[model samples]
Target: MSAPGKSIFFMDLARNAGWCEGRVGERPIYGSERLAPEGSDSPAVFAGLLRFIGGRLQAFKPNLFIYEAPRDPRHMGGQTNLAAIRMLIGLPAVAEATAYACGVLDIREAEAASIRSFLLPPRPKGSGRRKEGELKSDVFKQIVSLGYEPKNTDESDAIAGWLYACSILDGRVGAAATPLFSQT
Candidate 1:
């Protein structure tokens, strides 16, 4: 494959919008605050997330962008989550961001991947989530094949989309090899 020229920016915003504190390597890390507060949806909080992401991207100036596809709520396991519902409503914004970045940088969707694989990465071999090995391997191949891994889901997916777009631009992974779902 030709050397991937553009840089990919990957980012992910969890559906849960609260300051989650978790230990990573014995160090605590704090996540964003919950968008909704005390049984009510705060437009302020929601807009904050959008602004945070949009502002960050604008500052970083990535060549390509990708977003995780939202899930169908009815398909959710009987969970009536307001935040999840809210994310679905905002899906267009995500796509619009992609278009804007493309127009600004003259790049296209290079690739796409499930948020799970991008954010979680893959389970270590002979460890957890072995089934993910194949999918992870596939994404790795696509990432390395295309050429960059933008650390966050937002950036990674966007960058991957851009690389995928580049692949299309260069004609490597065709409509057949780059199917919506690869073989398990």
Candidate 2:
């Protein structure tokens, strides 16, 4: 980590066909469209993503890297959803590739729910759902709130995750705060 404000990178692995990775620093950067290759999570795909991730790390030189992990199907109210399928199917390769990257302890995992919780406004009175917004919409708003307009959904998710990790690292979201992820 660098000083009290570590530069951060957040990767939201493919929820469909490709993944999205974002870098945050003095100036936010998101060159995520090329991070994922065709054929999903094949070994060759992983190899390509590795080089891409490494190159981005070298270019941005972030002090910390955080990625979204696949959701636990058991926690999805026992219903199989497309999001879970894409995550379980497409992300091991991404995680493995990232873990094998630079020697520095720059990588970590931040659950999507955790990031949302940290960024979401309090639940509206008498309503379980967010007042009048979609999660992605709010996340995008937060990215804008942080002063960056994300280029894509993956980039948006990454930015949200980066903010969540920043809150934890910067002391806004502490140990008493809702945990960032469940036990594996």
The candidate maximizing lDDT is: 2
Q: Residue 155 in candidate 2 has what lDDT? A: 72
Worst lDDT run of 10 residues, candidate 1, spans 19-28
Candidate 2 C-alpha error for residue 62, in Å = 3.1
Per-residue C-alpha lDDT of model 2 across residues 1-184, encoded as one tens digit per residue: 6554567767776523223333322345564545445555455555556676677666766677677876777776878867556547556556545645654366777777777877656666987675424887877766665556777666777766765666666554322222333121
Please provide, for model 1 over 1-184, each residue's C-alpha lDDT reduced to its tens digit, 9 standing for 90 to 100: 9553443333333343311111111111223333445555445545655665465456555555433444568877878688758766564355346447445344222123432333234556878553535554555455434334333323333334333343443444323224343232
**Candidate 1 displacement at residue 111 in angstroms:** 11
lDDT of 2 at 151: 72
Q: TM-score of model 2 relative to the true fold?
A: 0.68
Error of 1 at 162 (Å): 10
Over the full model, what C-alpha lDDT does candidate 1 score relative to the true structure? 0.42
